[model samples]
Target: MSEATPPADAGNTVSVAVSALDLGALLCSRVCHDVISPVGAIVNGIEVLEDEGAADMREVALDLIAKSARQASARLQFTRLAFGAAGSAGARLDLGDAEQVVRQVLEDDRTKIEWSLPRELLPKNRVKLLLNLVLLAGTTIPRGGVIRVAGVGEGDGMGFVLTSTGTNARIPAGIEALAGGAVPQGGLDAHSVQPFYAGMLARDCGLPLRFALDGDTATLTAA
Candidate 1:
């Protein structure tokens, strides 16, 4: 947790013990949290459409419905790859697919994403780790910001960096600790469980996760 120290304890090697069912439940909760807003918008639009006296606003309601549907779909697709088995077993994930999903979710008025990774395919596990980092980084910018994702080096020595910058940007406290490999003394919940899961993935893959923060900017790296 220190600025000079790596995000994870270099010499320490312990992982939180989470049951399969518990992990599944937590992940599902995350997915629901992401999709609910857009889904609610869609329902509200339908209700507006059903109001005969709201004829003057029908076009606006339709536009709202369309936008919300797209947002909901984008979230579901990203979640599938990030939390579910998106591709075949033991195969490299398609970078195009990953980029599409990310851009759909992150490239909006509030945030912009720049993908600097190689165009070549990447191992599925690595892609998952990268996407989860994006998800974590996106939450840092409350007002508006830029998230730059880059893949560097090669093979087991490969490194991934995610940098976020904006007004009032900051990583959430409990999530940052969990993502950096410190298990909370209390049990994980829907909000704090994601970083713990992501950290475990990095550790099991023999990657070291680190974080550097300065003022309103933060960088997360795994190498």
Candidate 2:
């Protein structure tokens, strides 16, 4: 028998690839999270209509149906951002989409923001990264507080930082380590659970992530 050699690309293992897939799966889970409530309401409303059978309450049933459809539509618009399949490739995201993305995650009544970011000065890839980071921050504040978004306009690249402060927030330990680039060794569980996308984006953009954390302060700097 003749000896055979391994392929050249065989040496390229699947660490980050597996992580990326896991991230995608996590994003899909979020999409379901955003959609299921509205979808269930729609189903329930239809059941109510069947029971009503052309009574005056039918109008109420129709209203519920309309509200459910609107919910689905809002979820669709939000998902285009939270899980849209446009990674890098020179895709530029304006401030409009970026705001929508972050606000979508933080829109619930739990928290409010005191933003001070450039309304329109980020690329799509960067926005995607920031969205992930902001989502991490938002998860920290169950009772809500102030989110300060500040940026410095460099000649070519802009540096942006996000800081969140609240009364009853204990920044999740997973995000704390991830922001410092000392995230857990696990792959997607680290990245997907934390803000690994921001770290990846900073690398892709040839920038560094500067993290400073204290008792109740967390700041993420992208240069």
Candidate 3:
């Protein structure tokens, strides 16, 4: 499904027209969107109990709220690498570390994940690319199934292959095209959200996000 309507022009930018800073902002906001939900909810919850005085049930409510807020923030951070502009090269990046980070965040959810990879860190760009790739793969299934993830690292950089196999594997339209290059230019066209995010993130990181769609599964990868 198409992601929520992006917030104004900051969210939509043609490949050529988009700048690094713009892409950075887009990534930052996408990160914010996921994080703010639980954090904001927690804050509001706190104000409610604090102002009203902790009722008998306040302890349980506060505990659940706190746990959920932490989970949401962790997930959002993992998603930043996976779906948003993660980081640049020359910085410390561990694919295995990232994988664990993501899996830890996702484990709290109902989705059952099957993972395969060596304990190693990849370059910044490849890590970011794979994270986004996994996010896309996860979106394809609701009931959930096995996600086979394979990674290889070399002198130039690292590469990853993520396959989410399950019934009703419908990949998002926008992300499918983003792997090649450039989404068509327009004023917030219908199929212009995921691709934009993918494209912009790739551009910002100076990497490519490519989709390899074969039958029921899609693979996203880059260096």
| Candidate 2 off by > 4 Å | 1-20, 53-71, 86-88, 177-194, 210-216
User: Each candidate: what lDDT?
Assistant: 0.80, 0.61, 0.60
List model 1 lDDT by residue over 72-177, tens digit each.
Answer: 9999999888888876887777767888999999889889988887666777878788888888888778887999988868754566888899988776655556
The lowest-lDDT stretch of 10 consecutive residues in candidate 1 is: 4-13
Whichever of 1 and 3 has more TM-score, that candidate is 1
lDDT, candidate 3, at 89 = 47
If the candidates were sorted by their TM-score against the true structure, best first, what order would they fall in?
1, 3, 2
For residue 56, give model 1's deviation from the true position in Å.
1.9
Clashing pairs in 1: none
RMSD of every candidate to native, in Å, equals: 3.7, 10.6, 6.1
TM-score of 3: 0.72
Ranking by lDDT: 1, 2, 3
Where is model 1 more than 4 Å wrong at Cα?
Answer: 1-16, 155-157, 180-186
Name the candidate, 2 or 3, with the larger lDDT value: 2
lDDT string for model 2 (83-113, tens) is 5755566666666666765664566566666
Q: Cα lDDT of model 1 overall?
A: 0.80
Each prediction's total of clashing residue pairs, residues at least 3 apart in sequence or on different chains, is 0, 3, 5
lDDT of candidate 3 at residue 131, scale 0 to 100: 67
TM-score list, all predictions: 0.87, 0.70, 0.72
State the lDDT of candidate 3 residue by residue for 1-223, as single tens digits. 1322222433333445556565556656666666777787787678767765658758777886888687787876686666543555465567667777678665434565666666666566656656666667677665566577776455435556666666666565444444334444552332343456655556665655555555555455554
